[model samples]
Every structure is written in structure tokens, then in C-alpha cells.
Target: MPSVNPPRGMRDLLPADKARRERVLATIRERYRAHGFDEIETPVMEDYVRLHAGIGGDNEKLSFSVLKRGLDAEAIAAAADDPARLADLGLRYDLTVPLARFYASHRAELPTVFRSIQIAPVWRAERPQKGRYRQFVQCDIDIIGDPSARAEAELLAATLDAVDALGLEGAVVRINDRRLLDWMLGHFGFSADERPGVLITIDKLDKIGVDGVVAELRERGVTPTAVDAFDAFLHRPQTLELRAFGEGSIRKALPEDAPDDVVADLVALGDAVGRARGIPAPYFTLPVQFDPFLVRGMGYYTGTIFELAHPSVDYSLGGGGRYDGMIGRFLGQDVPAVGFSIGFERIVDLLDAEADAAAEAIVLVHDRDLPPADLVSLKAALVAQGTRVRLEQRTKNLKALLERAAADGYTSFATVTAGQTAADLEVKPLS
Candidate 1:
């Protein structure tokens, strides 16, 4: 007989894992709702063109394409041979893309400066690893149509609040603007075309050290002086300070008539949000800075771009930014937008570690000894009382069941003992 197992990059979320994920998700949803964001749903599969629009560089490579098996064989074959054609339809790589398509298609139906929360699984074709998977959930919140810095500031505040509400410790939101990065590169002599490669290399700065970034830049044909100048700018103390545009030389170099106006607007917005919400104050300590080198590689971002990072982890928990131009790519008219995504798998990994340290468990006792009605009642009671319960099947022995549950990371267990009745059940916490 073949062993039953989930597909690679996916898993059977045991009860305890489900409980933790639910808890985190509930907290996030609650936070989003409290802030007046409506809930919206989009199809899991989208026309490849819509999904791939405005998504280029590294993210484009990770998209998972889908096709009809029999009905469109010829079309599928043609699409498979051409990247652009393949993107005419595919499973959504992230919620943001679908949301952009949604806004553009249904702008009349949505409110101006519409706020929405979308929590769903997004597909990717990347190789799986620790805390990284090809299929995973993403929690996203976005505001469309409002260009005020207040929206940006409020989103940052809400993100921090949501993470803290999940009871996770040491999560930090690192923010920078794409305009700042663009300005920095230009200031250091990187041409407009060179900016993309430089952005990709610099985005990895935290992963790879300064020398590694410099080396990669050199390999990409950037001058030695440009790399050194860029490095010095990023490391300066002013980079951490929320100085007004007039106070900085880099700020002066920014386009006099940039439409997004990230420098003055986003920084002030971050400051206002910081003053209003003290909880995320430390996380949003400095106003959104202009880090000319903070180029987020996604082609759609037209304004601010920020990332949430776990203080101890090298990878981002998730990130997003304003993409006023994304909707226009699909609808042929500009639609203002900003949003952020939470990396569900990374968050689950962090929560799992915390759960392990706390030694939380749910034990399932064999049901053979108890009458079926009694077992059902007991299970209902435990669940109703906010306890995660597992009911063991009759075929499993007590010792085997307990061992298996323990290995699966359950810190507590509730079993239906032979002598206990449904009306008078005794629930004990496992040591």
C-alpha cells in the first residue's frame, strides 16, 4: 500500500498548526476591519496577462502558470512556448496583482480611496525551503484612489498593530521609498537603465554584506566610485533621520516635478502616523526615509515601497508599496493604489517556534470506550470552550497515539477516558 502524504511544498496542517494560523489570521482580520477596510475576494486563477501585468524582474520568474487540460490544448501549447502568451492567464502569484486587476475592472463599483482586506493562498513556482513554500497564504490590505500621505501612514500603523496583535515578538517594519532609492542611485551616477540592476543588487544588501553588494555591482558594470558613493549615502546617520527635503543634498537632487512626491509627502505621513499611534512608534520611529538605493524591483511600484522584517530573520516577513500605475497598465487610466502583504509561511514558522517553546499540545483520546453520542458531546464542549481537541480513532493504541501526537508538537491533550461520561467530563492539562 502507498503511504498517504501531501504534495511537496504543502502539508496537512495539524490541529495545533491550524489553531495558531487561525489565531494570527483572526487578529489580522480584526485589525483591518477596525480600521474600516472591507473584505474582498478574487478568483484563484486569473488570465495570465492580468496576473503578469506590471510584475517583472524576479517576481515574474516565480509565477505559476495554469492551462486547461483538453479544451485549449493548442492554445496552451502555443502559450507554453512564449512567455508573454503564457502570462495571458495563470494562477495569481500574489493577491496584489489580482486586486489591481479588480480595481481597474470594477472602479465604478468600488468606493473612492477604497480600502480592502484579502487573505488567501497565492501560488508560486519557486523551490521550497525552510519557511518558504511554493503554495502559501498572504494577508493583504490595500487602499486605492487616495494619494494622501495619511493613507500610507495609516497602513504602516495598521501593519505593526496587526503583527503585535498576533503576539509575535521582535517583528520590525523597515520602510523606504522607491523614489529615494532612485534619487540615491542617480546622485551616485547610476543611469536610469542601470537603476534596475543596482536596485536588485542593493535589495540584497541585508542578505549579502557591503562588499558582496559592491562586488555584484562591479560585475554589472557599475563604476567603483559609484558603488562607494552609494554605500556611503546608505550608511549615513541622516539616512535614519526624517529630515525635511531642504535639509539634505540627496533630496535636492530628486526630480523637481516627480508626480508621486514621495520625499515630502511620505515622510510627513509617517511622522503623523507615528505621533497618533504610540504602539508602532518605535517601528515607525523615523519618518519614511528617502533611500535612493531602496529600489523595490517590482515594475509596478510608482511611489512608496516598504518591507516588514522579522528582527532575527534575514528574510522579509512581507512587503508592498504604492502602484498608482498598475491599474492603468490594465485599464489604460491611472488608478492610485497602495497595499502591503504578510508572508503567511514565514509568520507561521515564527509562531511555531514560539509554540514549541511554550510546549502547547492537544491530545486525542481513543473513542472506542465512549459512546458515539458522548464522544461528540465532549468534542463539542472542548471546542466550544476555546480548547483545541483531537479525537483518536479506535484502531490506535493509547501509547502509540500519545507518542504520535507528542512528536507532532502538541503540548496539551484531552482524552475521553473509559469511565468518564459526556455530562461529567474531566479535562486535565497535560504535563
Candidate 2:
């Protein structure tokens, strides 16, 4: 027999998986819609150039390329040697890049400030682990062509709302500004050219601790003084008490002086949005510490960037940021865009573990009198009514069927009797 298992790093999404994923997706879509974001989609496979041009940091290495046959052998050999030419098309790594390309290509059709939601699968050649898969769905919402910091505020609010809709407790939205990180780096004597590598290492601070970051930076050729300066800068009073500083404190730290004004604007924006939307003030919290060390590895992010992490989970649940220059790279005009993506598989894993405690078993009725067409109709109707119904083949006896359903943890059974024209459904509570 041929190999029966799925390829490594991928698995089949059975019916139960579909149910949980759909529930999460529906909740996200409804929440985003209520926040004034329209629904949109982009192609699954895009030209390699369009996808690669603006991809942030390490993602370029993870893309899964699709190559066409019948090309010259020498050309094929060369393409294989050079990643840039290996394939003309690739599975999309994330939704934001496609949205950027969409805005640039259809600038006239979209509004000045377009708000949209996209739920789709993205591919990466990653080593799979718990809650991490090579093929997974990303739910994204973005606002394009809006340069105001209010756009960032709105995106953050929508994110908070969407996760709350997911019913996850103790979720934190960690926010940081890319410009702040840049400023901090410049202030500490690291040149602009050296920021990316150092920042990427620092961004891993949450995963690995301060020592891990320092060690990684040293390995990357950063001098001891620079590392010490970076560490000390991260622990400054202004950085530590970010939530307490209103505007005046921000001005004192940087020569630019405008950061305080932006922080003030963000504070006001958060308040105005809460009042207008009738959202409770407690849903958004400004923790005291703001790390200027947080530089999300994405190259396109230019403004506010955030990560939504569950306190119980060691990994990030979702993350996104503003990319003002991304669309301009393709269309010759600057378009501001911001978005967030929720990992569908991670959410499902969390929900399934919870749902198992309230396990319910579904019983399928298989009788000789029920025709195939009728059985199909009955199964569809029961499913539409929010029931999980299993199908029974005619060969199975009631005792055997019941035994199987019991093993599957189904507590209820529905079936047609010998003389019955319509089906009879029964709920049986299991001990």
C-alpha cells in the first residue's frame, strides 16, 4: 500500500477541526465588520517578485516556491542555485503583502482609507511543533491609505475586541513603535545600518531572556559597550514608566520632542474610540514599561507594531504593524497600511482542550428502511441544527454502532425505526 500518512509538518483538518476553525473565523469576521472593516481576498499564489520585494526579515527564507517544468536545463540549474530565480510563483507567506500589492494595483477603485478583513491560508516551510504548522490560516484586518496615528489606535482597538470575542482570558496586546526603537538605537550610538540584526536579536528577548539577547548580540559582532548601552537604555525611567508619562516626559528624553505629542494623541485617540464604540475602558491597558528594544523583524513596518500573546501560551497568538512605504514600492505612491493576523490552529488547539472537558457523543442511526438520499438529507438537517451526527452503514448492528459511538464519546444518538417514515433523534447522557 502507498504511504497512508500526511506529509510531515501538515495534517488533515477533519470535521471537528473545521467546526472549531469556522467558529473562530466567524467570530473574527463579525467583530471586524462591526468595527467598519470590509471583507476582501487576494490570490493564494502570487508572482515571486511581488511577494519577495517587501517581505520582512527572516520570512524570505521560509517561502515555498512553485517551479514550472519545460524550462532550459541550464536555466533550471541556475534557478535552483539562486533562490531569487528558483520559482516565478510562491504560496503567500502572509496576507499583508498581498493586500499591499492589491492597493498598489487598484488604487483608483479603493477608497482613500480602505478598511478590510481577510481570512486565508498562508504557507511557510517551518519545522512544525505544538500550535505551529507549515500550512495554516491567518485572519487579517487592515486599514490602508490612512496616515493618521488614529488608524493605529483603531487597529489596536479592533484587535483587542476580536481576541475578546475569541473568549480567551488573560490576553495582552503588547504595543511598541518602530520609530521609538530606531530612535533608541541612534541614541545609544549604534548606526542605522546595524539596527536590523541587533533589533531582531533583541526582539527575541521575550522568548530568551536578557542574557540570551546579549549573547546573541555579541555573537553578531556587537561590541560590549554597545550591548551595555542598549541594555541600560531599555531600563531607563521613561521607558520603564511608559504608561505613566503623559506627554511632557516623552519630550524630555528625545531631542525630536514630537514623540510626546504622538503619545498624547494616542491617549486621546484611545479614549475617543472607547466612548464612540461603547467599549469598556478596562479592555485596553497601558502597562508601565515600554521597551524601545522591540523591533519586529518585518522590514516594511514603519509605525506602531504590536503582538497579541496569551499569558498561558509561550508563543504569540498574533501580530502586525503599520507599513507606510510598502504599497509605494509597487505603485509609485505612498499608501499607509496596518493589519493583525490570528493563528487559527493555535486558537483551535486551545478551544479543543477546553471542549474535551464537556465531551458529547453523537450517535448515527443506520436502518435498512432509510434510503441513501433520505440519510443525506437527515444528516444535513441535523448538522444545520448544530448537532454532530455520525453516519452508520447498513451493515452495522445497533449494539455495534452504539459501542463505536460510545468509544468516540458521543452521548446522543439519532436513528429511524423500522416502521417510521421520518427519523427519530434521542439525546442520551453518558456517565
Candidate 3:
């Protein structure tokens, strides 16, 4: 027989594992609910066209594709070399793209401004690193059809609360705007068409250092002057906090197309997020700050872009931004949207590191020959009194039973005595 093991990048969640995750998940859902985001669920598989509609960016290559069936099967087989043509459906890589398609398909039935909560597993066909996996859950909360900066402010504030709930200190969300980024690129001599590709390169700054980025940019044919100016900006020493960068020396270099009012907008956004009330009043330490070079990997972001990064690890705990033009791409009508997604797996890893693994459990050892009705009644009574119960058949060997319960994370045990009824139950601690 083959070994009973999960796939390379997946694993089973035991009972205690589930408890810890559920605890964190409950906190996140409560935060989302308090922010007025209603829950929504989309399918695991979406049409292959949805992945290629230009929203996924680098993620499209990582899609787990499903082959064609029914009507398209013949054409797919005829053109076997091109795998994309042979696939009609693919598993979703992220929730945002599918959400856009969902809204387009079911707009009439939804509210004018749809605030959605989608917590589900997404698949990718990429290399599995420390926190990256082939299958992982992503928690998304989006406010669609709202064009104001308040949407960004509220999303950041709510995410800060979620991060705080996860017990992460000094978790700050870095803020920037794609519009301002473009103006900066244009200021440094990049043409209209070069900005998008350049922004993608900029997004890789954290992964590849400035030298690596410059090398890649030069390989992509970026001019030397543009690269030099970008390098200078990256290496310049300055505090990333709002007050520091809000009045830094770099603030004086705004081009004609890039309005200087962006600073005012940043100040207002920071204030709005700071003022926005959370269930836990001060949800963040250094809440929202500025990262002039921060560009999220997704191509759909159009306006404000923000990311919440892990202090120890070089990955975002969560991130989201305005994708105003994405829905319009699907519906043929412009609809503004802003959203945020908490990286569920990353947070889970953080929690797991601190998890004790031996959370409280109670095991009920009943007689081997006990009637099923008696066991059921006893368990129900215990549960009704707000007790956690796990029933097992009582064997002659006391040591075996105790060892089994301990291995299963049970810290206490209970049993029925004397008469065969559940009412004559006794409880005792395992330790």
C-alpha cells in the first residue's frame, strides 16, 4: 500500500489545529462583520477566459487548469500542443478576479454597493516556499462601487484590527497610489506604455534588491536615467511614517502632471483611518504609513494601493487596493471598487508558531458493553452544561485508555458509575 500522506504542499488539520485556526478565523470574521461586509461565496472553478481577462498578472501563469469537455473537446484535442486552448476551466488563483466576474454575472440581484466577505481556499501551480502553497485560504473583504478614499481608509482600519487580533505588534499598512506612481515613472523619463511593466518591476523591489531591479529593468530595456533616478529614490534615507515622509525633502520634487495635493490626500487618509472606530479601539500601533516604492503584484489596482507586511517575515499578512476599472472590464460599465485580503496561511503560520498544541479536551470513557442510548444521553447532558465531550469505549486496560486520551489532547476524563444510567456520571482531571 502507498503511504498515507497529503500532497507536497497540503496537510491535514487535526482537532486541535482546527480549534486554533477557528479561533483566529472567528476574530477575523467578527472584524469584517463590524465593518458591514456581508459574506459571499464563489465557486472553486471559473471559466478559463476569466483568468486570462488581464486581471491576474503574474498569477495567471500559476493557474491550475482543467481540460475541456463537451462541445470544445474536439477542438481542444485537435490543437493539443497549445494547452490553454485545450482547457475550458481552471481553479481560481485568488478571490478578487472571480468576485469581479460574479458581480458582472449577478449585478441585478446584488445591492448597488456590494460589500462582500469571501473566505475560501485558492490553488496555484507555483513553487511552494516557506509560506507559499499550492492550496491556501485567502480572506477577502471588498467594498464595490465606492470611489472615495474612505473605502481605502475603512479597509485599512479594519485590516489593522484583524492583524491586531492576531497579536502582531507594529503591523503597519504601507500606502501609495498608482496614479502617483505613474507620474513618478513619467517624471523619470518612462513613456506611457512603460509605466505598467516598470510598476511590476517595482513590486519586486523587496524580493530582488535595487541592483537586481536595475539589472532586470535594463534587461527589459529601461533607460539608464530612469533606472538611476529610481535607484536614488530607493536608497534615500528617510522614515516611512506619515509625519516624516509627509514633509520630507522628496516632497518638493512633484512634477506638473503629479499633483502635490497627493500629500494632502495622504494626510487626510491617515487621519480618516486613525479616527475610524474599531471593535478594539486602537487596533494598530503604527497603523498606516507611506511606502513610495510599494506596488502590489496584482495588475487590477488603479488608485490607492496598501499592504500590511509581517515584521519577521518578508511577506504581506494581507493587502488590497482600489480596482476601479476591473469590474468595468467585465461588465462593460465602469464600477469603482476597493478591497482588502488577509493572507490566511501566513497568519496561520504565525499562530502555529505560538500555539501550545495541547488545547483543552474532555474524553468520556463509557463501558464497552454500554447501550448506545445511554452514551448519547450522557454526552448530550454534558454538552448542554457547556462541556466539551468526546466519548470512547471503556476497555479493561486503564493505562491504554489514559495514554490514548492524552495523545489525543484530552486533559480531563469523565465516566458513568454504578447504575447503567448517564445521570450517575463522575469527572476527573487527567493530569
Q: Which residues of candidate 2, in runs, are more than 4 Å off?
A: 72-74, 223-225, 234-258, 269-291, 352-364, 369-411, 421-431
Measured over all alpha carbons after superposition, the RMSD of each candidate to the real structure, in angstroms, is: 4.8, 4.1, 3.6
**Candidate 2 accuracy as TM-score:** 0.83
lDDT of each: 0.71, 0.71, 0.78
Query: How do the residues 1-431 of candidate 1 rate in per-residue lDDT, one tens digit apiece?
Result: 87698777877887657766776788789998988899999999888666655565566678877644453767767767677754446778888888877888888998877998999998888787888777899999999888777778778878877876776777765566776667667768888888887888887876787778888988888767887787665555533444442224334444344334555675476557667565254333432344444556687787788787766787778888888877777788887889988887788677744543332335656555577777777777666766556677755466676666665555566656665644555445554
Clash count, candidate 2 = 5
Question: How big is the positional error of residue 123 in model 3, measured in Å on the Cα after superposition?
Answer: 1.1
Better of 1 and 2 by TM-score: 2
TM-score of each: 0.80, 0.83, 0.87
Q: How much does candidate 3 score in TM-score?
A: 0.87
Candidates, ranked, TM-score: 3, 2, 1
Candidate number of the best TM-score: 3
Candidate 1, TM-score vs. the true structure?
0.80
Tell me the tens digit of each residue's lDDT in model 2 across 1-431.
98998877888876545655676788888989999999988999888887777564567778888886567888888777776666789998888888888888787998889998989999899988877788888988889878877787777778778767777767765666787777767766677788887888878888888778878888888666777787675455654443432344434544453456446654565565465456565423442223344567888888777777776788877788788888888888777788777777776666544543323446666766667777777777767777666777645456776766555556676555443332455556543
The lDDT of model 3 is: 0.78
